[model samples]
Target: MTVRLRPHHLLCLLTYIGKGYSPAFIAGLTEIARRVNAGEEVVIVTGPDDICAPLLEDPDAHCHNPGVQIRDANAARDVGALLDRDIRHGLRMVLTPVLVAQMRAAFANQDTRSACARCDWAALCSDIAADGFVGAILQAQDSTAE
Candidate 1:
């Protein structure tokens, strides 16, 4: 099954290191990270993707926040440009090793980080990238000839 992800989550998957707002959130992200690492395809969605599932119970979930919508838009723009694809709802992709390397380089250089503006975890992600992604959980492999 494809993992449903919001646009910004494409970036989030780059630097996730098992920390979150709560234990449930961390568990959900960890599970998704594992599945993604294990080779699940990722399908883009407009809002409230699998990463937001654990936080959905809150009436004031940040997933529903308007700022998050802007973040998604920015992430789509940056990632789309980097990938040379129209990153819209229903787009399917895999985080292949080469692709991941390119993305990580861009992320480390802040080339695709417009979406990280105002994010609570932005600093942590920056630090992770600065440190060569130490402790990051996701692992990517080339699934096809490129």
Candidate 2:
């Protein structure tokens, strides 16, 4: 099965470390991370996606926020440029080790962080990148090209 994701989530998965708004949210994201690391196909979507699923029922959910949409737009732009592919809805891919490694390199350099502006988790993600992604839950299952 495929994992449905929003563009910004492409960044979030890079720094996931078993934390989130709630236990259920963490659990849901953890499962998604597992699937993604296992080489599942990923399909980009427009709005609230698998990462937002556990919080969708909340009255204050940020899934549909304008800022969130902006983040998505920024992510699409950044990741699309990095991959040289349009990172839009229905764009399909597998996050191979080489690709993930390249993304991580860009992330570590803050090259793809326009999508993280105003995000509550931005600092944590930045720290994860700076720390060489230690303790991150979603590790590539193979050696990176480096």
What's the residue-level lDDT of 31 in candidate 1?
94
List CA RMSD, all candidates. Answer: 2.9, 1.6
Candidate 2: RMSD to truth: 1.6
For model 1, where is the 10-residue window of minimal lDDT? 137-146
Candidate whose TM-score is highest: 2
TM-score of each: 0.94, 0.95
Instruction: Give candidate 1's whole-model lDDT.
Output: 0.91
Off by over 4 Å in 2: 141-146
Q: How many backbone clashes does candidate 1 have?
A: 0
| Error at 44, model 2, angstroms | 0.3
lDDT at position 137, candidate 1: 89
